[model samples]
Target: MNSPVASNESLVSVENVEKVFRRGSEEIHVLRNLDLQVAQGEFLALMGPSGSGKSTLLNLIGGLDRPSRGTLRVAGEDLHDLPDRKMAEWRARHVGFVFQLYNLMPVLNAERNVELPLLLTHLNRAERRQHVAAALDVVALSHRAKHYPRTLSGGEQQRVGIARAIVTDPTLLLCDEPTGDLDRKSGDEILNLLQALNREHGKTIIMVTHDPHASARASRTVYLNKGQLSTEPVI
Candidate 1:
């Protein structure tokens, strides 16, 4: 399975984390006192039913949202401590996100879409193109660089999204139901690509998925229920 041994140098560590939301005069707790650690180079899967707070936990790790309480340390930075602007900057540099919807810009071609995150960096135009090309090549989509999202198939579009996510070589790859919208064949292709990224490229990935088949590919699977962890990770 190539699951990594637990160590102190965890890439992601959530300690006593809790999340709550309020509407009008009522308060709802979403997550309660959760703790987790994902070692470097590990591919961890979070699985649960709808509204189980699986995505919420993924968001906290990806720096897309803040925890209402507790500490979130990812890639050695305390995400809970970073200000909004700094968090954005940190996310740009350290985290890559892949969504189920293949959030590509309809107006932009594949290469341009992959180049979006690099624009936030100090890379020049030429450098950005080089990075974009490399990323597309990694995903075996170099031939589709000039194609727009609307013209590509669902799997191809998701490949572009994957390319976009990895272009920056971020420290962490966060995937939220990355293959949710694809056919079984296409979803398997994407999962294979993600597996290659983890095993070959040594990318640290945390994926949220409901498919047990998909979760089976991960090094470990953790289940969440009712906004709380229901069981220890299944190997």
Candidate 2:
């Protein structure tokens, strides 16, 4: 699926971003002077050992958390300045999130689960249904629209989660360990789906993963080490 987004441009920019957690008199810097830039429609992966701050970096980019210092911009908006209310709006309009846990309501059917994000918007019911239907179709899960989470396999549930992430047609997709809980076959399927979403839909994707194979699928891979990105390459 080719992205509907226009020309190649800087969709996300991080400049000297730093995150420091102060506990008592001690300070823990999760990210130190980090710098990253993502072009529109590009797919990038962040990888590192546990506690390397890959997840912290992803959270900062997604507006789930903020940096202690530095300029972080996404979709032309400086994230450091987006207040809580405005950040919520920015996230709803410009960014989509996918998690390893396949965060879905157990009671909701696939379609309804995909519709959850739309509830945050002003889109009417008819428009919302169209968006949900299209997103599911894109993921080839329209057939499972009525199925509950328990009825679907792990892969299917994850696909539903992906659908829900893309239903809002956001420009940026931020994923945290998307395949951490899946079997090889299911993880491969999910990876292929994400590639399609990036290439065909032109969604700029930033994914964090421990799997080398998974990271290899991305156009570029960055390593987070000791609170900063490493210039060294492991491959």
Give the candidate number with the greatest lDDT. 1
Q: For candidate 1, give the lDDT of residue 142.
A: 99
Q: Which digits, one per residue and each the tens of the lDDT, describe model 2 over residues 127-219?
A: 999999999998899899999999999889989999999998888899889999899999999999999988877778999999999998999
What would the TM-score be for candidate 1 when compared with the true structure? Answer: 0.95
Q: RMSD in angstroms, all models? A: 3.3, 2.2
> TM-score of each candidate?
0.95, 0.94
Where's the lowest-lDDT run of ten residues in candidate 2? 1-10
Q: How many clashes in each structure?
A: 0, 7
Candidate 1 residue 125 C-alpha distance from true site, Å:
0.9
The C-alpha lDDT values of all candidates are 0.90, 0.89
Q: Top model by TM-score, which number?
A: 1
